[model samples]
Target: MNQKLNIAICSYRSATFGGGQGIFVFELSKALNHLGHHVDVISGPPYPKLENNIQLIKSPGLDLFSTFNFKERLKIFLGKKNKSSDDWYEFISALFGGFPELKTFGNRAKTLLDESSYDIVIDNQSLSYGMINIQKNLPLIEIIHHPITKDYQYDIQFSKGVIQKISKWRWFSFLKMQKKVSQNLKVISTPSHNSKNDIAKDFGVLEKNISVIPNGIDHASFTPILDIRRVPAQIITTASADVPLKGLDFTLYAVARLKEDFPQLKLVIIGASRPGGHTERLIKRLQIDQNILYRSNLTRHEIAVEYAKSNVAIVSSLYEGFGFPAGEAMSCAIPLIATDVASIPEITQSYAELIPAKNSNAIELAIRKIFASPETYQLRAEAGRTHIIQNFDWQKIAKLYEDLIYKTIDEFQC
Candidate 1:
């Protein structure tokens, strides 16, 4: 093994079961440490709670509007009292997009890079110009999980009306910054080939400069178990809270149609329902509100158990750069039916049954077809399992990252 290299990973949020960024940072650092590298995770609010061995450098955000428990801290700083979490969220939500703390994070990252000699600075989607302009001459490697442009496009198109659609177009501002910063980075890696192509097209970077490294899941933790919570005829999916791009409407419509044929059909959503949002309204209109189970704050093992218990797993995203839910479901050996969009087909090539992304009828038909035959479910699940184990084992993928780090270090030295 090569001598250990100190790796600095900067992410906007911690993977505290809230979203993918924290998960990516934590898992990547764990894998790097497992490979005998020193990994320092620097993050803003909603930080990852990693093991004791790994070093965590907190880059506290101004978070003017505290999202969760930061209201007290905000009060202490400003000499105020009795501010609620929602008030902080509303305040922060207004300014977080253009907040200067994010820029400060870049300065802090630069300081860490300068003082702590690292072989490489691995940025996990913190595409600020400060990171781009860091003084450290060390190789800077950026990991764009997927292009934000893809998310913006899907979200805009999913809007119910023209006004809402135009409103979403403003979120594309991140793309401009992402493009400018991405072009200067020497080695850029993404989660999937679909993402690689997206980066090439959207950011105007050459395909060769962008490498493909799929995200990994813990094989031991996500393994199949004897599931006791089996609802005889139920389907499960993980959706982003109030995000139209997730295709929750499509899944709800599909389940509504399937429920007529299979009345016992239930759509168990592994995400919290936003108050008075489209997801909640759709469930009400479909008259299947009673059949839906929406919950948040699930552990990895808990999610795996849900996968094991479900008759089938569905991913109804309008587009996925790389579908984490689909991969995790497959890791648990559940038959998958994901939207035939962006990278879903790439990961689930012949391993899954895919349907047109925005077609509710297609999703419904796929569900009916799978449940109609028990053997089909078994075959698809087995194939998905084989595919994931062969392609996405974290232990194997971690080595690629190790080799890439060494190669980047050598090139930087030369």
Candidate 2:
């Protein structure tokens, strides 16, 4: 048996419900722990929900985003008289439209981690300068889920106004630091070949230095719950509103147009929308507001229940390092339709129906096809569950990670 390693996984802010990054940290730590390694997830707020066996080290920093009101945020800046200089730096940077979490997280986490010795450290996408300093003491591996260059380009291309465009430019300036820090790292891990290629090109890293490891699915939590009766002509998708990368705008158009064919058709979104945001306005404009339902802050079991009740699933993402929703939906034996973009196709094209990106007609047409041939699509859906089980089992992925950790350690020693 190989010697078990003590690993610390770093994530700046891990919202357990909102995004994939938090779930990635939570699930990866759990999987690694199942293989006998000790895992400590070092994260800032909104913290990840981890199992009892795994340790959660609260990452110390000024978590500006969590303070919902501006008054409380102002207190964070004014209240701490003895605060470190980095606190002011973090707040001021964020005030100027820059994302300072990762940079600040590295500064705070390095000192916290140095108190304890670990054989290896796994950074979940915060390739900040402080990580470079921490790597001097321990072997480090970066899991760049995908390059942020895609997000940056998308934001610039889809800016709503001149002021918004300028704000976005400042917000993503951290990409420069990420690019600089990534180039010198000896080993890196990414979810797919598409992401690996993008990282290499954008960050100027060598292809050989990066490993392509697929994200795993928990079969137990996401299996098909056939006991639940499926709803008629209902569709499900996971997307955030007003985010061009998520392509929620196109999804709304599809759902609105879809109502003409199936007047009783329903659509459930597994994400939150700001009450007065662009999505709300779009819903009103389309006059199909009654046809849509929004569900957020759901547990894994609850999400599976929603999947079991739905007739089909659509993924309208313009880009994804790994399309978790598609995999989770397929695991639950619901037929999937995802855009043919980036790593979505890399993992899902085998089992899912691929459609051209940003096309509402494609989404509407695919939904029609699935409903048209229920018997054939049902067979495909069941087959999808098997495919997810065989290809993306957690244990198999854990073993790969275990091997990678050992390899990183060996190379570090040499």
Candidate 3:
């Protein structure tokens, strides 16, 4: 057996409710721990829900996004002691719409980590300036799930006016720090080749500096529950947030188009849609309000059961660093219809009914075809399930990371 190593996974703001980063940290830590290694997840607010064996070092931040009430947030911000003076920067940056969590959390994590020892550290998409210093002491690998430039492009394209475009740019201004910090790092990793390529091009990092390590699917938890009767015309899809990036708007449009033909349809979304947001308004406008159900903060087993209950699943993402929902749905033995964009095709390995992105008509047609041919869909579902179980074992992924860790440490010592 290889020597057991200590690891720290840094996530500035883990998605405790409905996002991918938290799940990545939880699964990675659990898998590494299972490999006879000690793993600690160092995070800011909204931390991940890891298993009991894993340690969570809570490095709390201002959590500026916790509320919209200005006065309440102001009090919290004012009360924070100016230890490193990044608190002021966090306050001002967030005041003008810029996100400072990455920079602030990195400062806190650096101090906390300096008081301890770790063989290596993995920054989970928080490409903050502080990480460069952390790597100076301990071998560090930064994970940029994908370049934020893609999001910026979408923002510029979707903005309604000059003011909106400027506001969007301000919110994402942190990308400057990300790009600068990423360039100084010796190693970087991403979940898919699509992301690897984008990170190289956008962050100006050489392609040689990036490693592609696909995320592991916990197929053991997301197994087929044969006892649960599949509900007819019951559809399952995941849109973790109401952002345009997830392409929920297209999915909603497809559901609206399918409503007339499939009146019995019930689209169960695995995440929440913002109240009074575009999604809610669109649901009302399309008059398909009655057909949608939202289920969030579900455990892995719970999500699996939901997948098993569904007759079909959909992944209508415009882009994904990795399509976790697509793989998870397949793991549950559910037939999937996903957009062939970014890493969706690569991640699913063409085990899905692939369609072009941003086309509601294609999504509608794909769903119709799946329902039209049950025997064929069933075969595809089983094949997808088999592929996920064989390919995305977390244990195998941990071993890959272990090899990378060994090589990095060897280079650091030399």
Using lDDT, give the best candidate's number. 2
List runs of model 1 lying over 4 Å from the truth: 64-93, 96-104, 160-167, 227-229
Tens-place lDDT digits, model 3, residues 14-98: 8765688888898899999999998999999887889898889998688878876789779888777754577788878888888
Per-model CA lDDT versus the true structure: 0.77, 0.89, 0.87
Error of 2 at 143 (Å): 0.6
lDDT-wise, the better of 1 and 3 is: 3
Per-residue lDDT for 1-414 in model 1, tens only?
Answer: 389888888886674776687777878899898888888888876678786788888864544534434656455445534544433543454443433344456655676566677767888877777677662477778888787887887777667797776566544555677788788777888888889998899888888888898888776677778636567888999998788778888888888878887888878899888788888887899899878998688988888888778888899988777778888888888778888888888888887888888899988888788778968677778777778888888878889988888888887777
Question: Which whole-number lDDT from 0 to 100 does residue 351 have in model 2?
Answer: 82
Candidates, ranked, TM-score: 2, 3, 1
Model 2 TM-score, 2 decimals: 0.97
TM-score of 1: 0.90
Candidate topping TM-score? 2
Over 4 Å off in model 3, which ranges?
Answer: 81-84
Each candidate: RMSD to true structure? Answer: 3.9, 1.3, 1.4
What TM-score do all the candidates reach, one by one?
A: 0.90, 0.97, 0.97
lDDT of 2: 0.89
